[model samples]
Target: MQKYILFTVLSAIFIVFVGMGIIVPILPIYAAELGATGFALGVIVAAFALSGGLLQPFVGSFSDRHGKKGFLITGLLIFGLTGYTYTLASSVGHMVLIRTLHGAGSAMIVPIAMAYMTEISAGKNVGRYMGMLNIAIFSGIGAGPVLGGFFLDLWGRNSAFYTMALLSFLAAALVALVLPGRDSLTIEEEQGSMLSVFARMLHHRKVMGILLARMATMIIMVPTFAFLPLLMTRHMTASGTEIGMVIASRTIVNALFQMPFGSLADRYNKNRLLLLGSTIISIGIFSVPFAVSFVTLLLLFALIGLGEAISWPAMGALAAEEGHLYGQGSMMGVFNTAMNTGIFVGAMGVGALVDVLGIAWAFYLVAGFLFSSAIIAAAMIRPRKKTCISTGDKS
Candidate 1:
């Protein structure tokens, strides 16, 4: 059961992200062509984050009582179908609506996948399993931009969208055909209303600390993925392919380091790792505006990736530990909500900063926010005694 669940979930997520990735390098440029200003771009990104964040806790809690496979399939199908709608968007409003729908699909997928994985993993090795999951995620994302860029440079912008649609559909099909049904996999646990679960979590200091730290760290995503191409265009000459390569550099490095760092997370102090990792990320983001050449930007992004690699698995393990008490689906749902909230805040904040000051200020401001979060995390998160959960030995 563990082997089957791991393989199916990882494979599905990889394909879905690859489809998602193909658009990251070009989506902002596409939006701009439709007459979107900096703030308009932020609106589009925030719309997705907001819609997705709102749905996660409910979907997660419901999945805990019901079954996960159905929601997973439905979400993947929604995700695949939404990719085609992007090509039909004629105005920024249209784009925002489509992205909102996309976020709904997102609300169903990754968090549920994390919940499934946590359920089947031995408690002592949560970080190691999470590391494996991250490798699939980072690897797909790392490969995606390059392919998107290639399609854009060779065929046209629309080609990338069409390819994304195809890949997403394939992923949905993969999950439906291979993963076991609800009865085979669902683990019954005591679960309450989503709101009740959320209320309890809000009062739990360690969980709040983890959620805040996750949100703060993720705030850099908007500037890094959505605005980096704009920054590159202003600073120096860059092609679509070059922009894709720079983005890929970070995720690829992150994928490469997930295992070793995951092992460290299992053995060492997770909070210290979080601090060390966030500090590194802050330094990398702060240096972004200074990068004048492609190589320089690539190296800086790679440094950020390394920081994430060290921190991400540790964070995942902590969340999984908490999942043992709160229920995995419910815990991951709220966890991912914090992630979306960070991205939404970053999108709005950075977009306004770019319009008011310049693109460079966005990077500077996010770096400062992340550094501040590291301090708060240090104060709130403490080392916990390890406990192991058994994975039933079943085929």
Candidate 2:
């Protein structure tokens, strides 16, 4: 990737993820303050994921038929605008609506940005490049909560929203200025229907497997963000700032570990790394309920973060390798949709479970799911003795 393009992708990812992370520690409290019940809070959180999930296929198809840059620009603009509107919300209903809009932007941006990255990066270095992209994600996730917590303490929750908005706008501006010009398609191609693209994507087996795994991982992950704060507060008497610190710690560890894990995936069997990651995640989830102090929670969160670091880049590299059979845009779109749907379901299910069954059981259930996913990943992933034929290069 060109230095400028890499910078643009990183900046855009940082902006979107930071905006998301800022809300993670305080969103449930914000919903409760707005008079939402547990179910309502679940709905509010799910609304964003649902909207983003639904839009992915359409946005991706449009980008494939049209060009990447237009969708990239449009998506970033929408993200920035809707992100600002969160400050204006007065109730959970309004928050849900705004979050849905934000999800729409998410659906457009992620797949296309990844596709653009794939197009620009050399096949030999794709895993490393994707790891760098994930580094951007973890950086945003790591820093946002710490900064948000500080702002929440000093200024207020509203200040966090404004800060997110400002960062998003700056990112959009950077993308507008630095990204290469939009690719052109002939008139005949421009007239092609998006449904045709969707139909084509559905039949790709490699894409389907990667998407399923991506979805499963997200389902395992989202619940941690959704319920961990409440769990910490209830069990350990953690304040908001301390909760943010724990969250940031996870991201910090994730960022620190991703590049090494990505390099490992390149050298060894990506599937093996994936299995190891899943096992770590399972262990971490199981440990969460046993955390009796902030220090314990931090340690468990670090384990979870390490698991995430191993899984994400390997998944991306695998998806990218598989995607060569289809188009990169289509595969990424499907993957993003599955992932977002998992997030939506996981967040809502965990919240509801907490209300009905209890928080401890919810953590156990999520842990079971993670372990099950690990087993499935082990059974399904068969590493080729030779490097992938499509890339024509050894890791």
Candidate 3:
């Protein structure tokens, strides 16, 4: 591993994510504390995703042409600034406006870092490196909630915000000192206008296929987060602690297995892994109605986590390889856009579905949609075709 590039980037990302996690579990309650109603609270939560989704592609394309470090540093600063200002938000409306800007900061950071990661890593190890990067995310996700609870209990709300601000500042300073300056633009990426660049990247059938699958994967995943707790508590009589345990189990599995699964993507058939992993996730989701017992429910959620561990490394590897062929930053932007869009659409759309069609049918619809996408992914990106598509890497 290149300690300066990979380790430093990972450290910055992990710390940023910890800040993110610290705010997430408490944001709604904090909004209510500020007199936000249900709909207002939803708006406060969605603001970040709305802004992030809109900005991610542009940030990515620009970074490819100019440099990643500047945007990365700027994003961290925005995040740190937002963390500090969070202490000043007096009402729900204030938080919503601040959170919207906060989303842009979040958008700018991760994809560019991903592009930089690919820029520095060996081609053969893209999957492994990406998997390693994901650990920072997983660790942050795991740590954030526990820490959020602790901070709220002990240090108070304002202290958590200050601590988060401090972490983001530390992250920014580390990246500024450690990572290299501007990257040289790739020949393939440098030739086109912004609109044309996106057109060319999206024109590839495989890119569309992979991106759609990525979106669909998030759709399935989000519904679990949105609806599962409701079902567990309302029907199964599961306690809040039990519900949290089940959720944490998924995060733990994902964090633990990402590296091993990433290693497998490097060593074996990526499409086969994608196929198998999606199938496992589908199985877990489709059987959710049957998870009557607490232990059984936990196992199902674990299966979903296991499938995520197996599947996402391959998805990320393919995206990086495409970025190598076309444009690293732009392609990563598209990938991130797919993620945010999925979170937004999945949460809203499936929440609607649950009201009209009922939970069982909602799970089936999402699972079926997700399961079929694996076929599209496999059919569109064949092994030989994948090799043939790399016209030339001019990096």
Error of 3 at 11 (Å): 0.9
- What stretches of model 1 exceed 4 Å from their correct place? 186-188, 383-395
lDDT of 1: 0.87
Q: Clashing residue pairs in candidate 2, if any?
A: none
Cα deviation at 5, candidate 1, in Å, is 1.3
How many residue pairs clash per model?
Answer: 0, 0, 0
Worst 10 residues of 1 by lDDT: 386-395
Please give the distance, in angstroms, between residue 48's alpha carbon in candidate 3 and its true position after superposition: 2.4
Q: Give the Cα-based TM-score of candidate 2 against the true structure.
A: 0.91
Candidate 3 local lDDT, 285-334, one digit each (tens):
88888777889988887888899889888888989888876678888898
lDDT of 2 at 344: 87
Q: lDDT scores for all predictions?
A: 0.87, 0.76, 0.76
TM-score of every model?
0.95, 0.91, 0.83
The candidate maximizing lDDT is 1
Ranking 1 against 3 by TM-score, winner: 1
Give RMSD (Å) of candidate 1 vs. truth: 5.0
Displacement of the residue 234 alpha carbon in candidate 3, Å = 6.3
